[model samples]
Target: MKRYLAYYNENHCENRNYDVVIVGAGIGGLYTSLMLPKNLKIAVLSKKDIYDSDSCMAQGGIAASIQDDNRKLHVEDTINAGCYVNNLEAVNTLVDESEEAIESLIKLGVNFDRDLKGNFYRSFEGNHSIPRILHVNGDSTGKGIMDALIKEVKNAPNIEVIPNVFALDIIEEDNKCNGIVAYYKDKFVYFKSRQCVMASGGIGQLFSKTTNADILTGDGIAMAIRANVELDNMEYIQFHPTAFYSQDFDNKLFLISEAVRGEGAMLRNSSGKRFMKKYDNRMELAPRDIVARAISHEIDKSNSNCVYLDATMYNRDFLKNRFNKIYSECKNNGLQIEKDYIPVIPAEHYFMGGIKVDLYSRTNMTNLYAVGECACTGVHGANRLASNSLIEAVVFGKRAAGDISKRINYDFEDNISTINTRNNPPNKGRQEFDVDFLKLRIDLKKLMDSSVGIIRNIDKLQNALNFVDEVLFKIENLKFNSVLDAEVYNMYLVARSIIESILNTKDSIGSNYVEEYSRHSVV
Candidate 1:
């Protein structure tokens, strides 16, 4: 969680000629960085330490079809789960690449959970017909995978991972991405590359309850919108059915993985009722959209603070060994999982809409590419499946890299003007800009969480958009340097992009429940 301070100079860099400049250090960005051709110059930018991202915070395993599974069935399940709105080409590509991505991970030394027969163990998640999810160390799959990738990336030759580099906006020239204008420290530094990839994750942190890291504020999505990139289904935010409700943090919830349901955990209400059965026949095994809506419906009817997840079906040994993280966290909070039922409720988790990109990861902008959760490839239409987030990041990250390698090189004009600053020459003074801008940022996050959270109607969304529009205007009018100012500006842009997108979609579908619009039709 260490935050570094850096300054970018308009002039003093030895290696300014790069083929690609990526604006995130998460798995997607890092994977692209590593998979890229060794001869091509690549730079990865991050606002904080590389590992400080939602990729690391992910608790579930990566979903893929490996042993004896059919890609056609996988595609069918994905399309069915997404309510048939998925782009078949993209779905096929993602489904087809799942095994390769899993094998790639294993080649990178990722220690996936294994069975007694010495096979790669898989588990079943909601809506999946088979045990296709390949987990690592139970609930710590993401952490284990991220650690391996980071180690491999650090030793890579052609990649430069620049942490604490905040990408303010995409530098688009003549309708093509030239590079990005990022503040490295207090100074506004410009990196001109032919290709720019945004793997900047999601907007979960903008809400009150989420399982994402704080860095998941839709930065890349915002920057793309500022550059006029097309965003699809912005309102399709996926709220996980049950999060461990914390009474201590004013009901701030933490994730209790869907795998618990796969292992037979049931959802119960205050009156000791298994309410999910009343909503869907699948009960706890229903898709996240149905599960979340059912829970929301129950809460409305009961007028209760939250629901409960009964994990008593599993034995104590299984709970302690398999779900150690969930067990310990609950115990530390003065609740025992084996005895007391875990208090829970649905919370904002994943956003299924973002800067729309094609199968090659190219967005509407000519040279700009987007991957990870930040880019909407029309793969997850209404609701994202249980563990497809990590898979999508890897699959698209690879495609973007492969496509970028075949493109012609971009050359920036030498007459680029630098931002005016006087704290330590034009270069180092950029680091001296006011850090208090980060405080204003906290206020922006509060606004998003309060207004644009799980359940939204017309009035709340319009109000949220109005506030965000004003904030964006204020940000444009402010005098600030590269460091915190750039990051805040980027966040504001992403917030507005998401809010605006959510406002445009009329119907209530999936995680996006619009009370005023009763229709579930998709345009």
Candidate 2:
């Protein structure tokens, strides 16, 4: 793994120092930076734009225990959805602070939808006993939250948002993290900081069909793995039950939010026969794992590529207003939500496993933290409950910011000006980059989708592991020059690790692969 590290010279590198270096610019990173004391210099690096994050793609809104909702129910629902494998302390922390997380977002000018009475227009989603999911502008909660946060980030004096900077590795010395090795304009940019945060989203792009952004290639996760950070539940990958099915598998699939079914949509086979009754008594509102498996079963039995989401019971005007994003997407594809059943199939949607972290979002390593989808904070166990990802991001982000603040003056800042660690700097590795990354990525996605999709057997897992070995062998001599090359390597590392974790898990079941508690670490 050391042979594959990002290269740099102690003398030729351009060193940029900050009080704190955040490796991602998603909701978690942005909120963490904004929450930090304004007197501190903060730098937020984005692989693409700050807007390009899984947090920014969330449409179903954040979950919180407000009003009639109780923290007990929220925690239970989360634990239940996670197959009771969640860390009790982390679950309690998320639910106990859920309201505060929502309030913080609102205070930051996130205009959640409200009725004329000035009350929150809360909605329903899969697996929840009540309508606690809050949205903004009907179906654009993610963009809405990101818009407000981006505006706030722009307005903040001490926070610097650096776009198009790809974080390559974590810089550490004597088992303590120092900063990040990043790539900008084809040069090594060493970010010297007292603390570092990995809010760099999830490992979604490793699949053929996912709802994640193109830039989400698990860079942070790979970096953590390279740094020997303890990872948890890596086998528990959550596939959403409703991504709009498409023939063109190259692009990021459009996700049909679970809120659609929460709003009374029914699942039907291609023959127009309702199918949920055969899978679960809950029908259209089962947990994502159950629903995705049911859909896969139906697809297998019917010999079709997709099932239908029948939202026609609602009038066009109502659907247009409530799910305008989905409605417009269907319309663009020559389908009508009011007149036709929208074609949907389960796709790789979210990663439940990530860099293991405590309630404070601190990883096993010192002065390092991870939040958002990339952090396995024990909130979402084997399977995530709907609408929890966004709230979980901000809640843990706030905690990480507070913890960093407490430890800021606690740790000494970089002594010398230029990223000059007292220890010897990392040297460049010799390699080749003569292959086509585009083709490698496409083929890798195909293998992951086929082997580790909604259904998996031990045979498939072994084959996938073999494929990972083959890919690694082929790229063993490849040079890490371009961002695409870096991302491909990250994807390969994450893919291999996830497959290995799955294979390592005893008595594993279908898509909702659970692990033995022996693999988890609690702080």
Instruction: Provide the overall lDDT of each model, using Cα atoms, as 2-decimal numbers.
Output: 0.77, 0.84
Steric overlap count per candidate: 8, 2
lDDT of 2 by residue, 1-523 (tens): 6433334664367888888999899898999999999889999999887777877778888889976687898898888878788888999998889888888998999999999999999888988888899999998999999999999999999999999998887878767888888888878888888889999988888987888888888899999988889999888888999999989756589999999999999998988999888677788888888889888878887899999999999999999999999999999999988999899988888888999998899999998999888999978888899999998999999999999989886457456555434443245455655888888898889998888776666777888899888888777566655778778988999999988998777645334443332332110
Q: Estimate each model's TM-score.
A: 0.88, 0.94
Task: Please report the TM-score between candidate 2 and the true structure.
Answer: 0.94
